[model samples]
Target chain A: MSTALAPARTGSDERLTGFAGEPLDQRRYRRMRFIRRFEETLLQLFEEGALNGTTHACIGQEADAVAVIEHLAEGDHIFSNHRCHGHYLAHSGDALGLLAEIMGKEAGVCRGMGGSQHICAPGFKSNGVQGGIVPNAAGIALANQLSGNDAVSVVFIGDGTLGEGVVYETLNMAALWKLPLLVVCEDNRWAQSTPIAANLAGDMAARFAAFGVPVREVDSTDVEELSAIAGEEVGLVRAGAGPRVLLIHTYRLCHHSKSDDERPEREIADRWLVEPLLVHGQRLDEADRRRIDDEVETALGEVVATARALP
Target chain B: MIFAKELGDTLRGALTDDPRVVLLGEDIADPYGGAFKVTRGLSTAFPQRVRTTPISEGAIAGVSAGLALAGYRPIAEVMFGDFLTLMFDQVVNHIAKYQAMYAGQATCPVVVRAATGGHRGYGPTHSQSLEKHFLGVPHLRVVAASLFHDPREVFSDFLGRDEPVLYVEHKLLYPQHLTLPVNGRIGDLLATSEGGPLPTVRLSAVPVEDCTVSVLAYGYQAMLAAKVIERLAMEEEIFAELLVPAQIAPMDWAPVERSVAVTGRLVTVEEGADGWSWGTEAASVISRRLFGRLRRPVDVVASEATVIPSSKTKEASILVGSAQIEAAIRAAAR
Candidate 1:
């Protein structure tokens, strides 16, 4: 399993380090790179038919998962949509268990019952569903409030999931009850093949703001920016300031899945071709970039080598 | 005879006995105490446990599912069972699918309580037996607690198990009652009752020990089935074993299968529409499993597959009574 590599360190470097001066340490950076490589490898295996079933790869949305998950404590809850490989990995889920789940193995996270779309790790109490777990997360947030626990419930959804009526209903109730919830919307500009501008009418942030929720928007590609904003938002929710929505503008470098090929639309593909890992890597100097690249490649190489050795 | 008041008291006592049990519903708090007064004084007794929620059926079901996931046994009420349709997403998709879809990642030990069935002209919106809607959803245990004694036992059994349960209480039977065996506590039946003149005829009794026929009945049909048994005993010297399953979804097949093995005949009676009813499904199961049991085919006595009429004449024509049950039993015997 391997991912196609983009040209390293070629894009605009000035705008990248503007937010929070790259707060990620070597360990965190290595972890995020691990997620990026893991997702890319999964996509390759899916295309090769080595892995069965469809997977929603978090190619460019790694920062959002990492940042939001970093703010969560061990007992904190997370609910994710179909595009949740990053969220599952960043929350310390078992890589083999997740892979097996996607492959429909009995040793999967849900014992092969729930496929790639329905991965749930009971240890972390993290669930992956197709926008249906939004209200369930709100209920979990309410439970946290009822129990007087400072733990927060975070739900990661796409801009398309906002179109679901239950999400809005859950938002309304979450706000009314002052539940500790963080609804992170990864606005990656496309809901499958359709563009978000063509589908959504008004501002996504304004909609949540209208519900009296403290809403924020950040550069979803920048790990530091997402971390800072997510930290602030998590604090606000933990302090009983009700539910909040963070609209993170990210990019989906790959197709929605291996089955979906969007290369026919060159203009659209070109516009959305912001490689998140390369962009983040470019912000650092030559030494930092080399160190990060080596670390990422070594970890990915180990994973691939290990995966191949499994019977 | 223990009435609805005693039943309510019994439930309150049970809740008091178990701290893990929590109740949430509309108007279940102090002063209001449930529409049918089943949860009367429960909120005051267990203030933190008994909670009142806004009229959000989806949230009610979802919250109960969450609490169950968190290891708290939550019994959520939908006030009227008709309103449960509003929460079909959470109940069917989330709560029911947790065990199977999650491969038992977490047990949804939640009980959804609601009052259902047509009685006292509550109109089309309020009066409906919608248990058939949730008949096939996996991992959800549906319990229709009609009699006072069976309800306590069913509730106890449901709470004892680590599965999501849909406890459907009849709106009309709320005022009715039955004398429980031990201080209003219905003990579990060790084996089904057998031993009547016909060997297939069994008595329809709550706090049932052992029975032969596994007579399936619920709501008003349950009372009618008891009367039919009594009349049969006096006139024809025929007795039929009755198995009133409090739980419906995972239809407690143990007793039902055992009863079928003994009697080799099964009769299902319901006061709901006949098309694709629970009775029909029960008949199918019995026929498939006990096909070579050397008796007659399973019989289903249910209401006509039509809209319940408002007029007395039309309603009587559409409804299933004791006579229909008796006829169904006779057909099964043949």
Candidate 2:
């Protein structure tokens, strides 16, 4: 996988390009764009008195969730961490329902009992605890593997979750049983205020490789490449190839939460230059980009309207 | 029959009958049939279903919840009750909240079985009756069996009920002889002896009258309470009724309350630490509900509120023994 931090030659401009004309690509692009806009609007929603409780928004890291989740079948399970708006929205693709949940309305997916951190729908489960979902995902995979079914499970975690012991335990069990599961670590460089360098002890890939999981690292900003890798690896896992780790390198363009104001504005600005949205959309024509933007805007409008209309 | 043998048989029977039942825990299979042998010969009977897991308490909990969500009834043995401190987040946050949080879209039908109580010198960490830690958690059930209440029913009734449960077992009660009730009633005051998890088996004193003090207990404490009751009846004619509810937390207060109403006194006993115990819950609720009728402030008999010691005498001192239970019963009756 390319480790280039600078945005690469985005993609060839032809519709016949291996990554562009595919229907999956369009759906992924739409969902990623929707997640970006959805999280952006959350800032305004927070500015107004619309949402209760805090949300760890995944604005810049949308590609990691969308890329893996889009390739997964509807029956496949996705367990998530606290940075979960993008994963739930990507798997279920229901911004209105998610927004309603945030607004505490009855029409929400969980009848508003589950807020942003615990947005659980069928086939998509997320809780607020870090590293808690790893073993649960392994168990879901165990069910599929035991029943001799092809329904795989994918878990999304941050580089920070490496501190939790259950992650290693789940990794060992997943490898031992040959459970069809993939662990996607979206290494967004920071765990709240702590940098990965200070927190990490040894090599990340070496740790997973010791557990016998096939490890692959990718540049999260390259959506097309990330999508292709996710598709291949998810297929491999579903086919009983045991567990794999997709260590996607990412950088968040926004604060960890609304209250997190410790980050330098200049560093965020520098990171946005290589944002997945700008890099991935480089190949889309003015009309294509405009159309995606229009659909996202219209969807956001419906979500906000529906959420506000609810008592 | 031995109470622990009954528990093992009940697990084997569930494995034979239900395809959805899956067992997960450390040393749960083959030569090691769980730490307490509560699952002996299970792997031999059904090798595919019984799985041995690493010492991942958190994962054991999470995997059980996940398995339940995926339509498998999992019985995860946590080896010792004290280890629940590690993985209990999955229980409290995920397993307990899944049904209510998801608005019934999901249900975690998992039973976590652990050996509890302070005896046989298992030391502070190993020998603790920790039902108090898990009691009153929403959407979760706490079930413990004494010499009277059989573990078989607990496994059969709750191991696959689309709700998460903590099934507690005591280390000392495994070898003790137990009598299985053919059928019984809770109390005379209850409208019916039947429905709900609070089925009480009342052992009437010889030439029984309106009972004196009602001794409320479960697990090994119930066994001790039964002994104290029998001794009190033999010697002092105290005539205290013993009420053991099958379920501890989400407790059904009607049976205990009715007994308390008839007796006008309550003595609660348990092996857990004195503060924040199931006995404490019983004493408090009964005191508040039956304040006017209560003959005295409810007497709560429980173990010491400090770390359980490894020394045999010290362990016995910390344990709520039959002597303390009998004293409490006598005081409540007076």
**Winning candidate number (TM-score):** 2
The residue pairs that clash in candidate 2, if any, are none
Q: Candidate 1 lDDT, tens digit per residue, B248-318?
A: 66665666777678777788888777879898898888888788983777778778877766666666667
lDDT of 2 by residue, A1-311 (tens): 22112111133111111134445545556667888888989888988978888888887898887777767764688989888988887776677778888878898888889888777787888888888889888889989877887887999999999999988988998898899999999998888988888899898888899998999988658788887898888888977799999999898777887878577788888889888888787777778778777867875787788789987
Model 2 misplaced regions, further than 4 Å = A1-27, B182-198
Off by over 4 Å in 1: A1-28, A122-129, A201-203, A261-275, B1-7, B10-20, B148-150, B181-214, B235-238, B257-264, B292-295, B310-313, B330-334
* Cα error of candidate 2 at position B121, Å: 1.2
Please write out the lDDT profile of model 2 over residues B1-334, one tens digit for every residue: 7877888898988988998889999998988788888888999888878999988889888888888889899889989889999878899988899889878888888899888887789899999888888998988898887666656666667853778888888888888877545444222211123344436655645422457878788888777777778777777777888877778888888878877888888888888888877777787888889989998888888888999999999998878888889778777777
